[model samples]
Structures are given as structure tokens and as C-alpha cells.
Target chain A: MNPVRTTLVWAVLVVAIAVPIAAAAVSPLLAWRSPAYIAAGFAGIIAMALLLVQPLLIGGYLPGLPAPRGRRIHRVIGAVLVIAVAIHVAGLWITSPPDVIDALLFASPTPFSDWGVIAMWAVTGAAVLAAFRRRFRMRVRTWRHAHTSLAAIVVVCSVVHALLIEGTMETLSKVALCTLVVLAAIKVGVDLRVWAVRR
Target chain B: MSVDLFTRRTLLVAGGAIAATWGGGLHVPAQAQGLAPTPSMRGGSNNYIPNAPIVERIGGGGFWMTGTVRRAGDGAPLAGQRIQIWAHTTEGYESDPHSHGATLTDENGEFRLEMPQIVPAFGQPHGHLAYDSDGFETVFLRPVMPSSKDTSLRADFVLRPV
Candidate 1:
């Protein structure tokens, strides 16, 4: 990549990741919150930020990195995303088991709970399918199609879940980051053109 | 390359187009009324103690609250009742500083607590109090906002028998 172009790409990446994080750091809600809750909330926000990176990596949009290299980083980041989510839920569970149970059982009165649970299941399903892909002997075309479809579901549901919750996250920055995540994923999905591939 | 494969230029263009449309309307519904703030409930990992150590008083700085625990049906004072209180203050929330404490009621089913003056992040200055005793259903009183004009506050709780 040329020097000017590389600088521009890096600037975009930094701004995209940093803006939301900076906003979260300055949230008024952190003033009187416990350490554990703060940790859990920030972990969730980091996971959401990671979602943006995954698509950019998959689409080969990061300057100076080959698509194959980006894919490798994508897999590593995916594992981190799972861990972050676990921390988020576990923290909540520790605080209130009854509430967590309600959310998992789909009996929670909170609408955000339903969306979060759906997105969580989608993410887990995608991870499991990727893990067992070789064992199932699935064709490349079929696997890609399923993977892309699940990715879309994950992005949409996760964004909606984040947007619905009026919690620690600052509203404007959260919405902006979620919108970027959706746009990035859709852009990559369109680029892959999975639907047009012949079996 | 496969017939369905897209060129790099196509991906870039698509990404730009999607970005351009993001500023438009995208609505997320508001949370239903009566939903509790999730942060206020974080009592740490070992929140459940079989026996909470008894303390004479729980906070400091001229802010005191005295209350009595009684049975809902007959208004009988219930002694030895364990009460747990947590709140967020200017310093931080419970577990951050000295924002949480526990105490047992005296012989007359009355308890006195000393707490730092609180100013909550979102709502009015408040505290969370819970009562648990044998043969009685657990009771939780949340967002117990204090009146600034009064140095000493009177807040009582009535528990229902199981």
C-alpha cells in the first residue's frame, strides 16, 4: 500500500474503534458502579467493537494485510469475542441469578433480553458449525452460505440488543458503532455473493 | 475465480454505499416501565452468606436511618431479622467502597443504620434494603431516596410470612 493510502486506512480504523470506547469511558453511569459490573459492561462493549473488526478483516479492508492473514486474525478475534460475552453474562449471573435464568428461559420481561439471547445463540451456532465443518464434510459453497446467513443474523440481532438497552453505553456512540457493524457485514456479504454461487 | 466472486473494487463500492445510508432512520423501542436498573443489583460473587456478620451500625457522616421490621398481617415486631442494605454514593456503588452492610434487628425488631449521604447516578439519592428471616418471604426495597432536609430518616419494612 502507498504511504498516503496506508495512513488514511489506519486513521479510519483507529477512529472507528476509538470513538465508541472513548464515549463509554466517559459515561456518567460509571461514577457509582461496582468494579465487577464495570468490568462486565466494558467487556460487552469490547465484544461489540470486535464485531466491526471481523467483517473488515474478512473483506480485506485493512491496509497492508493480505486477506488470508486477515482471516487468521478473524478466527483469533472470534474466540476472544466468545470469552468477552461469557464474562458479560457471568457477571450478570453472579449479580442476579434469577434475572439471568429469566433471560435464558425467554421468560424475562425485558425486551432487550430476548434480542441478546437470540444473538448469543446465533454466535454460538456459528462457532460450533465452524468447529465441526471438517467432520461434517460440508461443501465449500454450502458452508459459506450457511456461515454468511448466520453472520447476518448475529449482526442484526446483536445491534438491536445493544440499541435497546439503556445502560452503561453512551447512546449516540453505541448507535454509530452498531450501524457501522451492520454496514460492514452487509458489504462483505454482498461482496461474497454467496447466493449466486452454483453448487 | 468463481462466477459469483466479487472484485475488490465492487466490495469497496458496496461498503461506501452502505456507509452512506447509515444516517437514516433506525428505531429501537424504549424499555418497558418498572424495569430495575441492572447495575444496582451487583452484590459481588459471594453475595449469599449463610450467616451475615452482625454490625451495630453500617455507615457514617451524619446520615442515619432507623426503621423497624414487623409482620404484615398482625403488625407484630419481628426480632433477629437480618437486613442487608446497599447503595451508590458519590464515592461509588456498593462493593466499590463501604456502600454495603448488614445488621440484625434488636429485641424490639428495630434497627439503626448510619450511611453516607448518597447521590445516585441516574435517579434521586437512594438505597436498596433487603430483609430475610426464617418463615418469612424475602423482601426487597429499592431506590429508597432520602430527603436531604432531614438528617435522620425513618423507613420501616413489613414482611409477609411464608
Candidate 2:
């Protein structure tokens, strides 16, 4: 990609991630939330935004970084994404353990909790495999298929989770970010053919 | 008979205002100040708790939950119907026990409760109201504020009695 196009892509990605974070920070609802709850909420928001960048990093959608460097950053980001999810869950746990427990057990009445819990598990599975693939002597092709499927689950379920939620991000902005995340995930999935591992 | 007829036919135009807010996001406009019926939206009541104690106010100051309780069809002010109000307020989260309270309508069918300002939860500044008093169909009204700065949220209910 030319320098101009690369800059434009990077700029768009930045906006895709940044605007929602900014919008949530100023949400009126934050006024009454506990610090732990607020932290947890933002952690979830960051995790969702980071989802937009992960595939782009691995698939070389963002131009300036070299392939090897981008992969390294992708690994680092994967770790951060996991941590953000942890904080998000922990914060909610502190604020309301019963609710979190219900969510994990899949007995919560709200539909969003079910989706969020599923996404969280998908993220956990992908991270665990990525972390131990070398020790397990996992085939690169096998790992690719598992990781891709889990990533798809994370993106799709998390979008549903966030959309089902009514807080933090503005409606239009949340919709915009979610739409972009799905589009980027699709672009990379189709372009890179990560979904299949016939080779 | 005519009074009952009016009450039955009376559509809480409040839904139109709610629709406007729904179309634009929960930014309650000038019209949501009137009482409203949930119509078919009890989904947002996922956080509802059973039998919250009636109290004088939810929080300290600024925000107000005010509306009228009218009989469906005739729009008669139904005094004595217990109206439960709760929200994520400066004092507590909507789910917190302390944040919930119930109030009764005056003879005029008007209800009012003062509390700390409502903050956004899940990103929208909103309040929850319900008519849990028996003898009438239960209603849960989740009304959003026009802006974070708005101190008052009104959701009048024209309840249909069973």
C-alpha cells in the first residue's frame, strides 16, 4: 500500500477504536459507579476495541509495521486483550459477585451476559492455545484453524454482547465501532484464508 | 361508561415520545415528561428486584421522578397505586438495594420523588418506574434523560387494571 493509503487505513482504525473509548468516558452513568465497576467497564470497552486491531496486526492490514514485528505486536496485544477481559470480569465480580457467577454459570436472565461469557471463554481458549502451542508441539495448521474459529467466536459474540448492552458507548458510535470490527474481521478472514488449514 | 371508554381507548401518547427517544437513542425529549406505559417492553426490567420497600426519596438532591398514575381508558388519576422508582444515582447504582424506592400517587393521580441525579448505566442516563400495586396490571417504565444535565425524568403510567 502507498504511504497515503497506509496513513488513511491507520487513521480510520484509530478512529474506529478511539471514538468509542472517548464516548464512554463521558457517559453520565459513570457518575454513580464504583471505581472497580468503572475500571471493569472500561476494560471491557478496551477489549472490544482491541478486537478491531488484532486481526489487522496479524494479517498485515496496518502497513508501517513489518510482518515479523506485527506478529510480535499481535502476541503482545493478545496478552493485553486477555488482561482487559480479566479486569472487566473481576470488576463486575467485585461489584456484584452473584451476577458474575450467574453469568459464568450461564444462568443469568439477561441475554447479554450469556454472549459476553461465551466470548470470554472463546478468548480464553485461543489465548491458552497460543501460549502453549510450542510445548504441545501443535501443528501450525491445526493451531491456525482453532485460533481462527475462536477469534470468530470472540468477534461475533462480543459484538452481540456489546450491542445488547446499553451503557458506556453512545448508540451510534457503538454501532459504528461494532460494524467496523465485523467488517475488518471479515476482510482479514477472507483475505488471509485463516479459516481453513488444508495445507 | 364513557369515562371507562376513554380510559380504555387512551393510548399513552407517551409511547410516541419514547419512540422518538428510541429512534434517536434514549435522549428523552420534551414530551416524555408525561406518564407512560411500557406497551410491550418489559425487557429492560432485567435488573428488577421484588418488593422493594417504599421510601421518601432515592438520593439527596437535583433529580426528580414525577408522573401521574391514571386508569387506562378513562385516564382517571388512580391515587394510592404504589409507584416504584429506582436508578443509578449519585447515591447508589440502580441494582443496589438503597437505590430503589416506591411512592404512592396523590389524589390528583400525580406522583413525585426527589433524589440525587441519575447517572448513565450501560451508557444511558435513565430511571426505572413500576406499578407493582395489585389490582392493576404491572408496568415497568425505563425513561432516559435528554442530557446528563437534566434533573427530572417523567414517566406517567395509564395502567390497565386486571
Candidate 3:
């Protein structure tokens, strides 16, 4: 990908990731700290990882000139994202093992926790599905369609998870993340519109 | 009329007795207490051990002190806290080992303190603390300093990775 596209991707990722973090940073001012903050932090981390995965799905959809290069970069970023997500989850585990376990196992008492867990499962499923797309004999267009739909679901669910949560990034981060979600939607919309016009 | 009256009286008394028994069973005593079957205070997991020990903040800027931490007042390792050690370098874009590093201080302060794990050239390190190739390397937290002193504990740390 060119610098512009790379920059845009990073921009979106930063906004998606940083907004929640910013919210977390101001958590003390809000005077709210509970299982909610831990939930929010984990959601942010997972969303950040998903942002890194976005370019991979993009590369998968858009073919031609240096496709292999994009795929390579995607793998590298995916690896890094895994480490980051692990760190995020690990921090939570150390902080509150019971709640973390609850979230992971779909037993968390809070409703928003379910959203996060669902997003995690969806993202994991998408990754696995993409890995075995060929084995399932999924046509390129069909697979791309499924991938795009799943990606949207992941992003949307993650955003909802973050919004419902109050943590270090209580307000501004949610607003910022919500804005990025809107921008990402616009980008996807434009891409679809262009594709439709061409069709 | 007499038989009917006697039968009604007996039925009423039986019903009243049942109702009284039910109420007695449902009622809580005047000395009702909170919690139940009090488990041993020393046992089970209701104890909050203060996981604050897991977050270790080290190697950063702003009158920061670099040191090592161990358990108790001994040279034992303290682990499981979020240990973030950070410091800064004078040169911009230059690497500093003390910039920002994190580790879970083990039960003993035998933490294998790695320098700030930055993306090097890719991502911008957020905090102002710097960790470059030069300057104070490897932090081994000795228990000599108390928590009241430099929070980092200023324990002796060697340059080698253990």
C-alpha cells in the first residue's frame, strides 16, 4: 500500500484505539471505577487489534498490483496485533481474574461484557474462516462479502461495547471511537458505491 | 345446627395452627446476622491481596528514580504487579533504555528488566521517559530502599540480562 493508504489506516486505527485510551486516562476525573473500566480497557485493546486486521481484509478484497506485498504486511501486523491483544487481556487477568474469566467464558454479570465477548468470538471466527476460505471452496466474491459483513459486525459490536463502558476513556474516548466508526463506515460506503457504479 | 357449629370450630382451629407454624418457620430471629456459615478468614478467596503490586511503573522522566524491588525488606523478588519503569534521553528520536519498561516484579526482585520495548523506527513512543543504547542499563530492584523513598526502590541493577 502507498503511504497515503497506510497513513489513513493508521489514522483510523489510532483514533479507534486512542479515543478509548484517552477516556481511560481521564477516568479519575469522572470518579467512576469498577468492573466497567476493566471491561472498557479490554474492549479498546481488542478493537485496536481488529483495526490492524482491517488492512488485511482490505488487501484480500482489492486485487492486482503488489497483492502479495499487502498480504505480507497484513500478516506482520496481525502478529503484532495478537501480541498487543494478549497484553491487553493479560493486564485485565492480573487485575481481576474472576471478572476476566467471566468475560472470556460468557459468564460476566454485566450486559456490555457480553458484547465484548461476542465481538471477540466473531473476530476470531472471521480470522479462522478467512484462513480456510479455500478449503471451504468459498468463491472470491462470496468470501469477500462474508468477510466484509463479519468485519462490520466486529467493528460495530466493539464500538457498542466501548460506548456502554465507563473507564479511563469515559466520555471523549467513546466520542472519538464513535466518530472513527462513522468514518470507517463512510469509507466502506464509498468503496461499495464505487463498486456499484462500476458494476 | 349444633354438629355444624362444632365441625366449623375444629376446622378453624386446625387452619390457624397451620398458619402459625408457617409464619414461625418464615420469620427471622431478632439476632439475624449477615453472611453465612462463616468460613475461615484465613482461607478461601474473598481476600483482596491488592494486586497493585502487578503494575510496576519504572524508567521514566520527571525526577524519576531507577531501582530494583524485592519482596518484604529482603532481596527476594516481588512479582505479579504491573511494573512500569520509565526515564528519558536528551536527544530527540534517540533510544534510551530507561524510557519506558514494564514487568511483573516476581516474588523476588529478580526481574529480567528489559529496556523499553519500543517499535524502534515504526511507532512513536508515547511517554516522555527515554531509554537509549547508552546511559543506565538493566535495573535490578534491591529492597534496600523503602516504598516511602523513590517508589522504584533504587535497588542495584546490573547491565546484563538474567
Best by DockQ: 2
Ranking by TM-score: 2, 1, 3
Worst 10 residues of 1 chain A by lDDT: A91-100
C-alpha lDDT (0 to 100) for residue B122 of candidate 1: 21
TM-score of each: 0.60, 0.66, 0.42
User: Which digits, one per residue and each the tens of the lDDT, describe model 3 over residues A92-190?
Assistant: 665446557767876654456777667666766667666787798987666766766666666777767766653445566566656655555557546
In the range B27-140, model 1's lDDT, one tens digit per residue, is: 112222222222222222212333344555555545666788877655667798887765555454544435667777788999877766665322234456666567777666
For candidate 3, lDDT tens digit of each residue in B37-140?
A: 11111111111222212223333233333344432222233344344443212222222333444554356554444332221110111122111122223231
* Candidate 1 CAPRI category: incorrect
lDDT of 2 by residue, B56-107 (tens): 8775767888998887655567888888888777898767888888888889
Best model per TM-score: 2
User: Local error of candidate 2 at A82, Å?
Assistant: 0.3
Chain B TM-scores, listed for every candidate in order, come to 0.59, 0.73, 0.24
Better of 2 and 3 by DockQ: 2
Model 1 segments more than 4 A misplaced: A197-199, B1-162
Cα lDDT for residue A118, candidate 2? 95
lDDT string, candidate 1, A1-68, tens digits: 79999899889878877988888888776775667667877888898999999988988888977689
Candidate ordering by DockQ (highest first): 2, 1, 3
Better of 1 and 2 by DockQ: 2
Proportion of native contacts kept per candidate: 0.11, 0.39, 0.00
